[model samples]
Target: MITAAVLAALAMACAMGAWRLTFAKWPWRAPRAAILLWQSLGVTWGLASVGALLAYALEPYGGGVVYGLHAFVDSAVSFGTGHGLLKPYDLPRVSALIAGLTLLAVLVTVLLAAGVQTLRARRRHRVLLALIAHEDPGVPGVRVVDHPGAAAYCLPGLMGSEVVVSAGTLSLLHPDELTAVLAHEAAHARERHDLVLLPFTALNWALPWLSVVRNAHSSVALLVEMAADDRARRYCSPRRLATALLRFGTAGAVPAPDGALGASGEHVMARVNRLVKPGPTFPRHARVSVITFSILLSASAPLLWIYPA
Candidate 1:
């Protein structure tokens, strides 16, 4: 079926081309668009993976995978709705259904597992924050630990998110630079960047050997830092943010704490370059077109199920 072929092709392309898609220079001008496109790619890649397997199993469907699936579902629904008799599925159909359902269930299980693990990590880090970190009224809700290195990161939760920084890190920056750093860290917590990265993390767990998963994980991580930078930029000067990055980030290397994301969490050089270069605005039409393409391509997998082959 065209749908099956398309899904296969999409999976292959994503597996092969995710790096180019995520690391393109054009995204600098359209960070939000790039974020959407990346999110869509991550979601569709998983679905396409399962759909591609089901496509092979449904080979016995003369009208192609989608057609047989469509007809089978129609029959099941008809029987359930009491509009028709329940026709027993043939062995091949039963096998295909079981295989398809199993794959889908596995995908779901992976996602849920990723979510649970991330939450557990966040909870543990939050416990550490409460125990070792002290609340500073000057910084308001932020937690400051008396560590030697200049580090700033956040433990995110729905109600009890904590923005953490080292006391030595505080000593290294000007007040404005500190403000910029806090804004950047807050952006991570406020926007819930970890959740955005979760699906890719799950994919990587599911397919650790796949280069696309590794590339996507790192690329999405960098893009999220950029996204946080974009948020920080709204509150502070890019120069100050870049300056903070230079001193606290480069030599100091304030690493992201366990399960928590950091200001300098990914693509340090690339992120610094972005802050320093401050590239020109990308054309609105180009961003729109790319976003549209991403949406349609991501939607195609599900749409395939909606339409018959």
Candidate 2:
């Protein structure tokens, strides 16, 4: 049974990882649309994992490490009493101490990781602001910074929103192309893609072993970029957006900070491919199947948690 449980957990982990990589690599015509798809997948995966964990924990031999620790503590206490190292009155104190230490260890680890990520984000934001302030001056309501490579981005923040472009990027494209690029970044800011990614970001930090969470994040990021591209397309031509993306991508510019939207290497070929030959629309039946799958997954959560293995 234990072997079965271990294998099940391993399978779930592997499946999630594979899906994450697959979706992350899939090309999309619109980045924002891709992001939404990834978000849906991430949410579903997270819910399923949590449900499975709960189910496993409920089994007789479940809660593996935690239960083992508890049993070990109890045995140790009993042994100590038999050997005269501990008094009967001290039993409660020892148990409380063990539980408290365990809980503290877990909490501290989580908090420390969260704090590090927060600090890194803040530092990146500060550097971005300084870069923007120095490079693009006197642009009202938008601040543009310069990267060493070719790219454009908008970093959405509470008080210091910024738009960034690279020197190589400025030299590579025409004014119309730049406009389309800027518009895409603006769309990302307006739509709050960063906020949308927060949940998955937290998951990635908390559960780094689950590569699915990271894949979901990258996929969603690419999708959000594409979605912004789609919005830009409404204002400009697809050709213009495509041109900008290609030029920026080829220039080899690294994207801006964590929150900004910029062209990524992973999706560059896919984006170009999308521009050249878009796929046919999904049939009604396919759409229905997708919706049905989502609903069924959601409805199965409770059942997954309660059913005996």
Candidate 3:
């Protein structure tokens, strides 16, 4: 009933915020918290859907909610498995469960497809790279490819992951600048930003026409880059990192290799601007509050159905 409307409203709010964030640069002011918020938004949408369905199913039942819920679940189980006929009052729960189950399956399938697609693309790139790339001990933990253009990206895998920089890029940057680039790529690999990007990829696949899907992907991608920049800035000079990005920006978008995240994948100007005019980081309390809100918001949806008390 009312909770169903509340769930729908929360989902819409998250979607609207995601769409608006795509056009806004305020999130970069505190990249870590922003990334967490994006994650929460994604989780909130899925949970709210389930909650809405549950609230709708429960709306027709009154008195002895505990016993009604038991009957509802029993009916749902029987309907789902084709075992028994449902009482008219129990039909809503059975239908709701079926819809919720279908939604869950589709979500899971999309994510699995995205992950497989990414891994396959990366495997193909890695195979091609093995033939043309050479190991450069100078960079320590990365590989160097003698390509014409300046493209730097990381290939992550189950056994081993490789961070690759083109020869043109190596020759273009100063020593410190090169390290900054490495640090940024390393951050991506270390944090498994690929996994973080997976849900957005799935969303885009499942909802190609929805602007919210595209906006969420774009916003999430930039946040990942900004998070990496912050990590690199910890060990390297912010100016050096900014310089590398500026240089990469001039080198033109070296389209991040398929399935891999490149140093300059679109948002080059926004990233450079951020480094140039460093934004204020989220304070300790502020970060805690953001995280707390995310946890509660995400939990609210599931809690409404599971433990309504």
lDDT of all the models against the reference?
0.78, 0.58, 0.80
Runs in model 3 with CA error above 4 Å? 58-73, 76-84, 87-98
TM-score-better candidate, 2 vs 3? 3
What local lDDT does model 3 show for residue 306?
53
lDDT of 2 by residue, 119-218 (tens): 5785687675775645544333545445456766676676645666666666777878877777877787778766776666666777688666577666
> Would you list the clashing residue pairs of candidate 1?
none
Top TM-score hit: 3
Q: Candidate 1 residues 108-152, lDDT tens each?
A: 899999889888988888777778999887788889999888888
Model 1: how far residue 85 lies from native, Å: 14
**Residue 190 error for model 1, in Å?**
2.4
Ranking by lDDT: 3, 1, 2
Better of 1 and 3 by TM-score: 3
TM per prediction: 0.85, 0.62, 0.87
Best by lDDT: 3
Task: Please give, for residues 14-122, the per-residue lDDT of candidate 3 as tens digits.
Answer: 8887777677666787777778888888988976776666566665553222334676678668988999655435666668756766777888889999999998999
> What local lDDT does model 2 show for residue 160?
49
RMSD of each: 3.9, 7.5, 3.3
